[model samples]
Target: MIDIRDFHVRYGNNHVVRGIDLAVAKGECVGIVGESGCGKSTLLRCLVGLEHGWQGHVAIDGKPVGQRRTHEELARVQMVFQDPFGSLHPRHRIGRALSEPARCMGLPHGRDRIATALEEVGLPAAFADRFPHELSGGQRQRVAIARALIVEPPVVLLDEPTSALDVSVQAEILNLLSDRRDERELTYVLVSHDLSVVAHMCDRVLVMQEGCFVDQLTPEDIGAGRASHPYARHLIAASFPDAA
Candidate 1:
């Protein structure tokens, strides 16, 4: 559903994402794993139009991104950012936040859609009336997920969706995301630094380093001890210290 070819993103003279070529098929969950400063987040931002001033071809469902499309055109590709607290509005109630996206998209706006989104994210209906600060970290993240899913976009770019939560809460959110993907048949490009998380959530994994894709591995590579790239081995070793 998404294709990026020879994508290069730079800030002044410092290039962050260099020559990234990747494709994500419909209903496929592709994980991009790398350490901090590897440009994983930058690539996600560029794909969703948050970062401009880059050179590359990013196409979603055969339509090219950037000046070729309007804001509404880009809405088809939504993003779920890492930080739930910063992503949501402090003053607006959860209901309003969830409804605003649909309203912006000119879709139907009512309790039914909002309720369904909340339930789909494993959130209680009553929480909709509360503000973001009033909810726990997990609830806030769920609200963020609900907000993204409300648009019913075919592809969602998740930027470290579980990084901010505790392990148990992260598991819940991961399961929730997995269930949503299966039920809705949504395609995802998940950016994470955790190899184990990617192992559990993604069908295929892309290892990135210094702003480029260094290796691509299937779950079987991880299972059969076949990831042999230097950086891939480093990541695997760091992920399983006892085994190393």
Candidate 2:
């Protein structure tokens, strides 16, 4: 339940995201993959209202998402950024970070919300007392995910959700995301440079290059290493060099 038409973003003369059209259905997990400076994350920032200086259409579920979003609208959509450690404040404890969204949205049951969010993300309830530095890399990411879902948003924008974690921890986080999506019927737009990560989590993959989509691949195509675009093929080779 995201719709974009002719979306474009520019920083001075540099048009980072140019003339893009995309639609993601409800309860669908779609991934945008590309190299650095491809505008993949820039597009995501625009979706969640972080990048306000954008042109063209951007609507969520039916309502247009402009530079300013209402509190209710923001509560309906949330984002999980790439670096969990950096996203969370070093001074604030876990419980405060998780409950802040619910508080801002004026949602009740702050304690219950924090507790349930931690549980849903496979974290212990006592984690609320812990600080970010005290937790491992994976735990920090879990806290980030829990923070995103604490407000019970329908659409979640993920920016390289697993990139900061170790391989073993990355798989755990992926499974948790899949399970949470099933339980909540979430609509996710994930951005990552890793095709394998996208293949495992997304129903479809959009290959982006030079600020636009060059190709679209299904999970099957990604699994089979059948990339149509040269960029997509290169990505496959880079991610799995031995197999390629």
Candidate 3:
């Protein structure tokens, strides 16, 4: 549902994402894996229209995305950012936050839709009335997911959605995301630094380096053999500290 070709993003004079070409099919989950400062988050921000001033092409489905589109058109693509605390409004109730997208789109607002969305994200219906500060980190993240999913966008960009939580909480969130994607038949482009998390969630993986894609592999590649790219191998080694 998304295609990027020869994409390059620059902040001031420095290019953060360099000549990236990627395609994500409908209902598919793709993971972009890299170390810190590898431009994964920058690329995702560009897709979501947060970062402009890039060169080359970024197409969602078939329409190009940038600052040129209407707000409603851009709302078709939603993002779940890494930090729930920072992404959500402390003053806004969960229900208001979850309903804002639909309201912005001029769609009919209903309590049933809000309840369903919260339930789909593994939160109780009553939690919708609570403020962001009242929820735990994981719960807040789940509310963030609900906010993103309530729109029922064709593509959801997940930028380190579970990176801040504990391992058990991370696993629960991952499983919830996986189940929701399957149940909703949603397309996801997930950015993560954790190789194990990527391996568990993604069907295919792209390994990024510096500012470009260095390797693309299936889960089988990680299971059966070593990654061919030096940086990919290095990342794998670091993921298992005993091997290093």
Candidate 4:
């Protein structure tokens, strides 16, 4: 459902993402793991049309993503950003926020849709009446997920979806995401620095370094501490000091 070739991103002289290629099948959850400044989030920005300065061929759900996306194209893929509080409007009620995408896409029955979206993410429809600041961190993130799913997008780009939440809340969000993916058969490109989160959620994990994908591993490989590249091994060692 997603494809990219020779993807490169630059901001003037600093080339953040260099010559990266990726393909994710429909209904597959792929994880990109790396340290800070590794260009993992940059790749996602390009796909979501936030970083149009990128040079690459990015296609989502069989449509090529260009500098500006059409309404349909915008609805084809939605993003759940790293910070849920900042992503939502501080003053707007959750219902209004959830209805924005459907509104933009001209989708009908927005009220009912918003309610359903809330339920899908384990939030009560009544929460829609509340504001972002009125809810807890996990509740805000759930609203973010509901907003992403409101339009019924085929692909969702998650940038450190659970990173900002408390450790206890992280598992709840992950489980909610897993259940939603299974129910909707959604394709996900999850960018995160957490190795354990990636291992628990992704089918295939790509180790990234210096703006490139250094190695690819299955969850089994991560569990067994099998890493071929030096950086990959280093990452594994840091994440699992006790692994054999």
In candidate 2, which residue ranges exceed 4 Å CA deviation?
241-244
Could you give candidate 4's per-residue lDDT for residues 1-244 as a string of tens digits? 9999898999899989999999999999999999999899988887877878888788887777787888888889889999999999999999999887788888853678888889988888899789999999999999999888888899999999999999999999999999989989999999999889999999999999989999999999888999899888888888988863
Q: Where is model 1 more than 4 Å wrong at Cα?
A: 242-244
lDDT of 1 by residue, 98-137 (tens): 9998998888769888888888887878777999999989
Best by TM-score: 4
lDDT of 3 by residue, 1-244 (tens): 8988998887788878889899999999999999789899888887887776788977887887765667765777889999989999989999999888888877655788889889988899998799999999999999999988887788899999999887879999999999989988889999998888888899899999989999987776766546879887787777755543
- Candidate 3 colliding pairs, count: 0
Better model by lDDT: candidate 1 vs candidate 3? 1
Per-prediction TM-score to the true structure, in the order listed? 0.95, 0.97, 0.94, 0.97
After TM-score superposition, what is the CA distance of residue 63 in candidate 4 from its true location, in Å?
A: 2.6
Q: Candidate 1: minimum summed lDDT over ten consecutive residues — where?
A: 66-75
Sorted by lDDT, highest first, which candidate order results? 4, 2, 1, 3
Question: How much lDDT does each candidate structure score?
Answer: 0.87, 0.90, 0.86, 0.91
Model 4 lDDT-worst window of ten? 104-113
lDDT by residue for model 2 over 101-189, one digit each (tens)? 88888886467778888998999889999999999999999999998898888999999999989999999999999999999999999
